[model samples]
Target: MKKLLSMLCALLTAIGLPGCDYVNVKELQPGVSTAVEVRQRFGPPQHEWRNEEGSVTWEYSRQPEGAECYMITIGRDQVLQSIEQVINEQTFARVERGMTPEQVRRMLGRPASSQYFQLKQETVWEWLMERGSTLNDPTYFTVSFNPEGRVVGTGRYTKLRP
Candidate 1:
């Protein structure tokens, strides 16, 4: 169901590129590209998730030398809004106000754990990840949501390898 649509849009953004250059990914113009055009370009998305706003984001990951993943957001108008690299600090920093829980999940994968604090009336989702270094020290990202299910805040920490 959703997977098929994601794929359709991946080719939506990724289909036409002979080389699939991530650098040139910026070429996808938000105001210009239609979902059909995107499907025709990229091929199929590697993953897909729908935001609370009812719009879908299609993911495309390039493996081997280029271990990069892209999140392409197509608006209800079926026009593109943005293309983002999901695996970097810059992306992590973009976790901002009013984003939905699903958007965060789509960007960072599942959290390592989550907790609901009755005192604060919020649910916190945490992810344990490997930061900049390959030494395997754990990095953590926590996104907090209010009772209404919207993102209210975020946190991050790095544990250096000993």
Candidate 2:
């Protein structure tokens, strides 16, 4: 009986306790915060879709070039209605913050307009890209969010002159 109890406890501990400490984005809840809170904690979303009803679909890039970490659906009221955070490449890309201008240009190619501005007293840069382009061959971009999760700027790049 003692041996059996010990084994069960060990198994339970192994299964319930995580071996490492990491902030998992999967556990975020919407009603817990406003849209601004979500942005502040997770940084800028890789992409967002806003509906006529004012609901927003936020796609958080899992990697700089791979899957999406989390897909959160928020209503116009600013509450979390649904959340899906499974590892799938179709949802989002893994992107990192604090990239230099040259590095961004190299990764995303040349921009149609590279603008620099000050917002809330912070310096931001935007590189607008053309549409129908891939990460391997990107073309369209209305705006790029900083790791801080703000629309710092916008730009675009195309084979033909605009």
Candidate 3:
């Protein structure tokens, strides 16, 4: 029975079952959920950014395997301010040339993967995005930076999933 259960779990994962690492942020009310509660539910963040207003934005990246990256903000009072899913078309449009890699990371959270091209003197970061209305269509959004570490280009591509 234990072996059978393990097999079932593996099959579910292989078929891309939702909620594997999904967090229902709607249940976490802004201005109500404390920082401690946020940490309890999401565990430690991959990165934390301190804002000028004394707020901190925590990055929870579900990458490489999962398709969403969440940015949760905590006010100076230690209260939850907002929860945003940063991997989307709107955010992608915000990326522009001359922007630094840090700016990109802040806007989009951590990427699924990064690759450096030695000859081209460029670094490309990739993020897996939602299929949205399309079925079995795996999409990837990419940001490319030049040797100076400034945004040079952005692109998107889809690979059909079996």
Candidate 4:
């Protein structure tokens, strides 16, 4: 059953339907949309961050299949502040050595996957990126962390999708 569901999701994503419940952010108004409306559209968020000023930002990740991660911020007055896609090249450039996993997650939402290399004592987190116009290959942005959980480096690579 799980395998069937996974395949179904992959098919939907491949056809350009967003994997995150097919969220349509275009219909949502920034300052006019209510928290209730946002929740109704996107479903419950994967994680929520409360700002120092009392605003909240919710993360909706469509990863390991789809290429976008959204960060929707709601103001203290309960109005939607802004909707941002955080998995682009700009956000990837912000990741630096010595940054913690929490920092990376906050900047890029959640990664698509993570792997631990026992021999190298390193952990790598990868986020699948949107394919460029010139290539249909799968591209990934990776952040490698040392055993102490601090980022050591960042990388980008493309893989030919089968």
The best candidate in terms of TM-score: 4
Once superposed on the true structure, which residue ranges of model 4 sit more than 4 Å away at CA? 1-23, 131-135
Candidate 3: minimum summed lDDT over ten consecutive residues — where? 13-22
TM-score for each model: 0.47, 0.35, 0.82, 0.83
Tens-digit lDDT string for candidate 1 (12-58): 34543325444246445787878766655566666777877978888
Residue 153 error, candidate 2, Å: 36
1 against 4, candidate with superior TM-score = 4
TM-score: the better of candidates 2 and 4: 4
User: In model 3, how large is the Cα lDDT of residue 50?
Assistant: 92
What is candidate 4's lDDT per residue for 40-159, written digit by digit as tens?
567678899888999999998888776889899999988899999998988988899999999999989889899999998999999989655455788899999999999999998888
Give stretches of model 1 more than 4 Å off.
1-18, 92-105, 109-162
lDDT (C-alpha) at residue 159 in model 2: 40
lDDT, model 1: 0.68
Alpha carbon lDDT of residue 158, candidate 1?
Answer: 74
Model 2: number of backbone collisions: 16
Candidate 1 residue-pair clash tally? 14
Candidate 2, residue 88: how far the Cα is off, in Å: 4.3
lDDT tens digits by residue: candidate 3, 8-97? 544543454435334346556899999987765666788999999999999987786678888999999999999999888899999999
